[model samples]
Structure formats: C-alpha cells, structure tokens
Target: TAAAPPRIFPQAQHFVSKEFCQTEFGIVYPPVISVSSGELIEVETRDCFDGKIHPPPNENDNNEYNPAQALQQMKRAEFNPITGPIHVNGAAPGDILAVTLLDIRPKGVGVT
Candidate 1:
C-alpha cells in the first residue's frame, strides 16, 4: 500500500510564497517575496501598544497606593494596530500583486 500525501490548504493560494513567516506585527511574508530580487514591499506597522505606565503616587506625600489600578491601565494599550490601507498608484481591482522568487536562504544549523 502507498502512503497518503500531505494536505494543502485552499486559503494558502492567497500567498505567492508557500514558505514564509508572520512578522512580529502579523504581516505574512510569502516565500516568493522573501526570495525575490530587488523587490520592495511596504508593510504597514504601528506601535505594539500605546505607551502607558501607571505608578502609584509616592508615599512621601502621605498618599495611598492602589494596586488595583494596574488592571484598569491595561485597557489603555492597543495591540498590533495596522497603519494603513494605502493605495498603490496604479493598482486597481482584479490586479494581482506580482512577485518573483530569486533566492531562498536556509537557516543556520539547528534553526528553522
């Protein structure tokens, strides 16, 4: 008997490259784009989170400190916000984002 083959997902077609990883902010890099020569792509990125830290008032003023404030402060930060829905000058509906693969660099030993 023959062994079964691996499954290929339908949504995978959206990517030009089958081999790539998501950036820290979550943009998926396709293998084709990764290996392409002289190709530049603009990835919209934003601050990982809003800069906010709450420190209790100093006791030197005889003020009371509330540890419960940390939870309330957490909601103020935003996570992985995208900066744009930027429009390409010549891009129109039904136009495919064209890319060509020119290289594929392998990870070092013991690395993926």
Candidate 2:
C-alpha cells in the first residue's frame, strides 16, 4: 500500500498562549511556526470568546449575569484569538498568504 498522506492542520488544534494571540488592536505577533514556500500546514484557531463559555453546570455558575451582560463584561483584549502567522521562508513583503483547507472535522455536538 502507498504511504499514508501526512495530516494537515491549517488551524490551531488547541488554545495558544496569550503571548501568541492577537489583540483587538490588530497587532500581530511573530510567527509561531515557519514553513517553506509551497508547504502545507494545519493551523488551529480559538473560538471568539476563547472558551469563556463553559458547558452546563459550570457555564452559568461562573457568571451571575445573563449572557448579554456577561458579554459586555468580557474584556475587549480577549476576543477572536487566531492560531499563527505561519511564516513562509523566503516569502517577501506584500506576498499573498494563500491557505487551502484540506478538511474540517467538528469536535463535540453543538449548534452553530
């Protein structure tokens, strides 16, 4: 049989440290990982709230206010954390960052 194809993770598979996360001001930190030109990588991204909304039993337990109030109380700096800069070796400025999605498998059961 042929060798199994390598798995690609275009998004982050887990939560990244706050240092690697981008702020709401649009400032992006250094690249987390570097890849050669034309290389394929799987990048994982965080949810908009960065997992602040927990599951039942503990979900509302953390926040006394309703969802709306809770959302307002959340800090602006802790929203929409993305996975990586994914530096492409030898890539120059103004180069377009092209990413191709190979597959997306949703974990757990939830409505979008």
Candidate 3:
C-alpha cells in the first residue's frame, strides 16, 4: 500500500490582510503585529500601482493605455503602497534584515 501524503498545515502565526496596505511608511504608525525570528507570517499586498493601472476591465474598449492617465489616477501620497509595519522583535534602526521566499503564488495576468 502507498504511504499517505503529508498533511498540509498553515504556518503563519499572524495574518495581515490586504486592508493593511498603506501609502507611506512612518514611525508614528503602530505596527499591525510583532513577530520574532524563525516565525511564519502572512501578508496580503497591493500592486505597485495599487490596482489602478492593471486589469484593463474592457479589452474591447477603444481607449488606449496612457501612462499620464495612470499617473493621474494615483492620488496617493506615496508612489508605491506597501504592505507592512511588521515589527521584528529585537530589530533596531541600522540593522539589516534578510528575507527567504519559501513560496510565492502571484494572482492575476500581469507581467513585469
């Protein structure tokens, strides 16, 4: 008989949903959560353009893509909205952090 498959379990200790994304990084903003090293955390992120430029809803529309128009659409204080404010335990200013991507499943049909 074949061995049973390994059961998959979610490892994330904390979850930061897409609603947590912000346009600016500031020390004044309280962290959504604090985490220690070797811990698993999951964060939902918004696109660089904050979903304003992507998903040309109607492909059949005659309107052509305009970079200028896209820029205008972004009325954000920061050019890129980031999904963070994660407080790393023991981490301080000037300390460099390294990230290892275990898995990444990107959604939608956009290309770099």
The lDDT leader among the candidates is 3
Which one wins by TM-score: 1 or 3? 3
lDDT for residue 88 in candidate 2, whole number 0-100: 76
**RMSD to the native, candidate 2?**
7.8
Better of 1 and 2 by lDDT: 2
* Cα lDDT tens digits for candidate 1, 1-112: 5543232333232223221223233224222233232334433222333222234567776766554554355553343444333334555579876655333343232200
- lDDT string, candidate 3, 1-112, tens digits: 5653232326667777666777887997789888998787777777777766664447788968765677687676745788878999999999998877666666666533
Better of 2 and 3 by TM-score: 3
Top-down TM-score ranking: 3, 2, 1
Candidate 1's C-alpha runs over 4 A off are: 1-44, 53-72, 98-112
RMSD of every candidate to native, in Å, equals 16.6, 7.8, 7.8
Clashing pairs in 1: 17-31
lDDT by residue (tens digit), candidate 2, 16-73: 2334556443324677777776665554455777766534455646645455555677
After superposition, the stretches of candidate 2 with alpha carbons farther than 4 Å from their true spots are: 1-19, 24-28, 55-66, 109-112
CA deviation > 4 Å runs, candidate 3 = 1-9, 59-70, 76-78
- Cα lDDT computed for each candidate against the true fold: 0.37, 0.58, 0.72
